[model samples]
Target chain A: EAGVTQSPTHLIKTRGQQATLRCSPISGHTSVYWYQQALGLGLQFLLWYDEGEERNRGNFPPRFSGRQFPNYSSELNVNALELEDSALYLCASSLLPGQKNTEAFFGQGTRLTVV
Target chain B: SQQGEEDPQALSIQEGENATMNCSYKTSINNLQWYRQNSGRGLVHLILIRSNEREKHSGRLRVTLDTSKKSSSLLITASRAADTASYFCATDAGLRGYSTLTFGKGTMLLVSP
Candidate 1:
């Protein structure tokens, strides 16, 4: 089975611009999650979508938003991006949300560089 | 404000040696997982230890969790140059569901051949 896949392996944007990243989860997975791994900063949860619904979010701002499609793929959008927004955006997929011990497979991630 | 905090921040060891990294969390968790990232690439799931389980092993990796201490440790035996990567510990907590993983800063491991 193919694993989670992400688009635009690397991206470069400027301040105040908008950036969009994409992720396709593994087959048979129902939960899609997004995380931001900034340089020197660890992986931080951004958003969680389950069955096409926004289930939970992290401590990020509203500018960081995303949605899960019917096929379980997800897109992360950042509006009015700041230089600090430059980071690696990762997407993961799980069999189900809230199921303890289920491993989440991650994509290669899209590295967004805000200039 | 990270949930799991790995100690030492960074480590450098020789091949055939052992590497041990520790993680501490503040809140209760249903399961704690470990992941390895090569360079800045995507993270790969390494192991997961449930709250009820104290110890688990996968090939060359050994993980131990102590709910009482609210901490966990990951040990890699006979480390190789391929094991040179960043290791992070994540927690699955809260009632909102287990999909969200709060990861730590991770420990950067460098293995010399």
Candidate 2:
């Protein structure tokens, strides 16, 4: 089965601009997660979407937001990007974590370079 | 802040030697998992140990969890150069009906031939 898929392996955006990153979850997966792996920042959870609803979000600012579509695909939007925004954004898919814990499958990730 | 924190930010070992990494979390969790990532690529799930499971083994990997200490350890035996990668520990606070895993900064392991 195909794993999670992310679009635009690499992206470059100027400061104050906006960037959009897209991800398609594995077939049959209902949950999508977005994470930002900045230098020395580790994998900071950005947003979590389940069943077309925003389940949870990390400590990121409002400028960082995203949405999940009806088909379970997800999009992450970074507004007014800054140089500090340069990082690897990853998308993962999984079944909701509940009675039985579920493991998430990740996409290769998109390298976002803000200048 | 990430709930999980891994010990030994980086480690180097010979290919034949065993490599071990430890993770400590600040909160109670439902399950813990380990993941391997080569370079900056996507992560590959290695193993999952439920809160009730004390230990689990898969192939050359062994994971041990200590709930009292809120810590876990991962041991990769007979390591190879191909085993070099960053290992992360993730935890989920499952008390909530819906929850997500919080990943640690990760331990970078380098196995040399």
What lDDT would each prediction earn against the true structure? 0.92, 0.91
Stretches of candidate 1 off by over 4 Å are none
The single-chain TM-score for chain B of candidate 2 is 0.95
Writing each residue's lDDT as its tens digit, candidate 1 over A10-49 gives: 9999999999999999999999899999988899889999
Clashing pairs in 1: A98-B98
Interface RMSD of the candidates, in order: 1.5, 2.3
> How high is the TM-score of chain A in each model?
0.98, 0.96
Residues B39-59 of candidate 2 have per-residue lDDT tens digits of: 998989999999999999999
| DockQ (CA atoms), all models | 0.71, 0.59
Each prediction's fraction of true contacts recovered:
0.70, 0.57
Q: On a 0 to 1 TM-score scale, where does candidate 2 land against the true structure?
A: 0.96
TM of each candidate vs. truth: 0.97, 0.96
Clashes of each: 1, 0
